[model samples]
Target: MKALPYDELRALYRNFLHSQNISKATINTAYVDTFYLWRKGSKELFWNAVTATDFENEAKNALIKALSENSTGNVSSLVNGYLSHLRRFRLFLASDGTAEPSVLNQGKTANRAYTRKKKMDVDVPYPSIEQVEFYLVKWDGLENYHLQEDALNKLFFELCPKNTDVIDILLKASTLNDFYSTNIFSIYPVAKHICALDIDTRLKAGDVTLVGDIQYVTIGDIEKNFYSFATKYCSHHNPLDYPIYDSYVDEVLRYFRNRDSFSDFQDGDLKDYVNFKGILIDFRAFYGLDKFNLKQIDQYVWQLGKDYFPKNYGKKNRGDK
Candidate 1:
């Protein structure tokens, strides 16, 4: 049986450690690290191939491979510490409650487990086809998002691909502004400015200036920089080149940069579409995840951030997608 089916494994493991009076720190590590690999990193294809025969070595190897990018000096010790729980769980799986952890560690075991510092870093596993595919599944199953993609695609591509008139620009901008909860109160001015610029040519040319700052005329002549929304508009038009932006994307990138050092980019850099797309490119390359395109990458990264970093989502729907 695959390791993934054991949804209660974390609880069971935690209980076992507690019974042995294993340090709470160690128990917490068991919960968080396993979540990275088993919950987030476990692939059905990878785990299905795993069996009771040499399960420990196989599991260890898989963990190492998955963690190779960010493998640390103490990775071996950490993996063994992680495996302590898994080995018993595997036995319980094979023997069907005949060989539970309760039976094995009957006495008060030593509490000398090495405990990783709390939030020293997030325990996100390295990105792979499996993890990305998991988020892709979530994207497909996500509410209102896939539908929005279809409608946006039809409007931007089929109906009005070019921003030649104010109506075309207004409809596109307004729909996206509302769709994402971007909080653009004065949308018409932005649309007018975009319509004046040769937006189609700039988009086709991959102009970086399309991202930052907009000075448009009309009602009261206010200046606003709709960076994230601009990226989304461009991305909807050309997802291949212009990857979408939002706070969720920004958070995920920063988390990875801190966790894996995949790309060196400041938080403000994500506001620039060209820089953001480059950092994403760097991220894919660093993680050996070049198999997926920007569009696919965007879906998974956005979903992961939405799922994990849940602060201020309702108040600011910048990452609504």
Candidate 2:
């Protein structure tokens, strides 16, 4: 098969997908636009015009300058994506620098990262009945969607009868860090992506374990669980009207998933591994929201979907949509 120009290839995809009766959505459009732009704007096209040494030298210099200037956030990722796309494009270009191929070669290189699905372990820790009850009792006077507090109380009492105050338990948790401080509620919300957690501790790889769809908690579990929760729940469940965990992550995810329509799930499946980890991680660094308010980050991702996904997903069965 021939390799086509980036614009032409993308335009063809848009047409093909439209022909397939796919619903037009913002997320869909953005993927096509961005991918094409990335391919067109990178140094990959210079491969035939320059030696690998020259190409590498130029790329390294450019990358260094960008990094030294601290041009390192959303713009940086976009730039990287562009460069990567161009590199792939060069592989398809002729040695003479001619665009010989007129269509994407299907049997060529490995599939793109964006097209692949990742699998995550299924277990995570959940609150015990006593802890849930304790939280509810403490949150009793809090108004509005604090109903979550009531839900916690009920679930806890029903699930774990030997209840204790959640606050005290968290405070007493073995892994509390001096660099950061947080309570049980903070951990749960962070895991749920409803908000961000203040964790002073660093995670040892694989220290956090997921079991039977619930995450098992330990001192090192905070970051993984919180990161997973934001990706899964915040982007899909929360409404935009509510506060976000951090703004920029929200912006990039919404820009790509909801606005771009690249995601298969209408709400972009918070429970999906791709959403829960990769997407959120990339967005956190991409938009430079990693150091910002965690609550705000949650708000943005949730809000993106709140305005759109529910209309297509919540009330319908799988076949209904």
Candidate 3:
């Protein structure tokens, strides 16, 4: 039987979240208020909201409003993260119908949760090896910069296999690292599962924020172990790139790559999401290998942005230091 009404449950969860000591400066007030209202108004709507078009539209509108105010470029990322939190909470509400609303509310949108897209998949214009080499030979040829699409297409084709596990590791690890760094521990396993997919299509069609600016390296704990081991053993260590995910990578991806998705992603959001295996496959083909095995190339190439570079001298966040 239900231990309490959904309203009380949500209140309890809110207290629980405070007890956990997560910061509120990072959250969207409107979104959280909406969930609280939803919990109090009608428990029946949570089920319909998950797959309902009306709810999606409402959520989208709320997101657009939130974005309009966040000129600092955090709107999309925050909205995507919050919507994901709402979706998962709704799902759990539908299941046992017993969780405290506060427990459900403990969610911080860290990653894209819209993995199971219903729409028919579309073809992505990935690039070819020959074309990539040709572009490299004459990179200055295209003044307009539409060449980025071709480069990414080529990267996608080369890196992602038709169906594989390496892609799983990248997406899972990248997002998981994002979450752990941001202190969003509840969604770590969910991030891990999102990486394993039947196709590269999952991330491309989702309704959530993209995973960007991730520092998948660190010093302690089982979660930090993978990046820690890799960073320590890898010969290409860059002491200056201690915080690893500086604006250089973000801008390169935004300007040259034209990938607004990653540009809009945040640590909290990326941590909660599952990525398109295909996207990771392609990412690995182009960027992952150098990052995974050799550190010098990744560090050097990413550090070219001299103007925006953060002083690499700060003490590492406990995880990465």
Best by lDDT: 1
Model number with the top TM-score = 1
CA shift of 279, model 2, Å: 12
How should the candidates be ordered by lDDT, best one leading?
1, 3, 2
TM-score of 2: 0.29
Rank candidates by TM-score, best first: 1, 2, 3
**lDDT, candidate 1, 221-268, per-residue tens:** 555566777787788788887888877788778766755556677778
Alpha-carbon shift of residue 14 in model 2 (angstroms): 8.7
1 or 2, greater by TM-score: 1
Error of 3 at 220 (Å): 29
Candidate 2 backbone clash number: 49
Total clashing pairs in model 1 = 0
lDDT of 1 at 80: 45
lDDT of 3 by residue, 239-281 (tens): 2222233334333333223322433334332133232223223
